[model samples]
Target: MQFIEFKKEHFIHDEKTGNYSLEIPKDEIGFGDVRLQKKQDDGSLAKIDAEIIDDLKQIKIILESPQDIRVNF
Candidate 1:
């Protein structure tokens, strides 16, 4: 399997049915804690905690003051 960093175009869900959908931002990388958006009935999004998939690699967050958050792939 190939490693893919989470992108804005990626959709995350706890279940395969996708009853709940979360949109990730392109500039953001999976790290310590992340807030996700849930697709709603009105076609709007709501804030929810994102669930990390077991198959995906856990990204490490490196804190470097005044720099963008680094994620190890």
Candidate 2:
């Protein structure tokens, strides 16, 4: 079996909230908020919490199981 994974990152600026919104991809399966920050002198991302919104579409896959297979002799 083989599967493909796709991801897209978008930055949303809201004047009312005064924060940046992270929009996840529509075809991916994971959605959540992640912290992002500028790199410090030690080259580590700062601890900044950012909201991640998800607008994903439905995904469907069909596979043939062993019980569904039939053989004719």
Candidate 3:
């Protein structure tokens, strides 16, 4: 199966803050905050902390997972 990947231009990283920012236009994802969850070892999802910037235009995520992530993204 194939999955949709985020556009290259949408991914941004702030070197100073060690934060990964994803640029989502209001038209694509709406003008609201997006909830992100990380899959746990037990096959459950846990809410991960993230920061929203410029409304829905940007979302900052710090991936600190000790193991490899298997996100559906």
lDDT of 3 at 28: 52
lDDT of 2: 0.30
Rank ordering of all candidates by lDDT, starting from the highest: 3, 1, 2
Winner by TM-score between candidate 3 and candidate 1: 3
Residue pairs with colliding backbones in model 2 are none
Please, what are the lDDT tens digits per residue for candidate 1 over residues 6-64?
A: 33333333354534333333344434444334445575555434333422444322111
- Per-residue CA lDDT of model 3 for 24-70, tens digit only, reads 45555454445555456696667655554555354334443222122
Give the 10-residue window scoring lowest on summed lDDT in candidate 1. 62-71
TM-score for candidate 1 = 0.26
**Residue 53, candidate 3: how far off, in angstroms?**
1.6
**Per-residue error at 14 for model 3, in Å?**
1.8
lDDT by candidate, in order shown? 0.33, 0.30, 0.46
Model 3 misplaced regions, further than 4 Å: 1-11, 41-43, 56-73
Better of 2 and 3 by TM-score: 3
Per-model TM-score versus the true fold: 0.26, 0.32, 0.47
Q: What is the lDDT of residue 3 in candidate 3?
A: 20
RMSD of each: 12.8, 18.1, 6.2
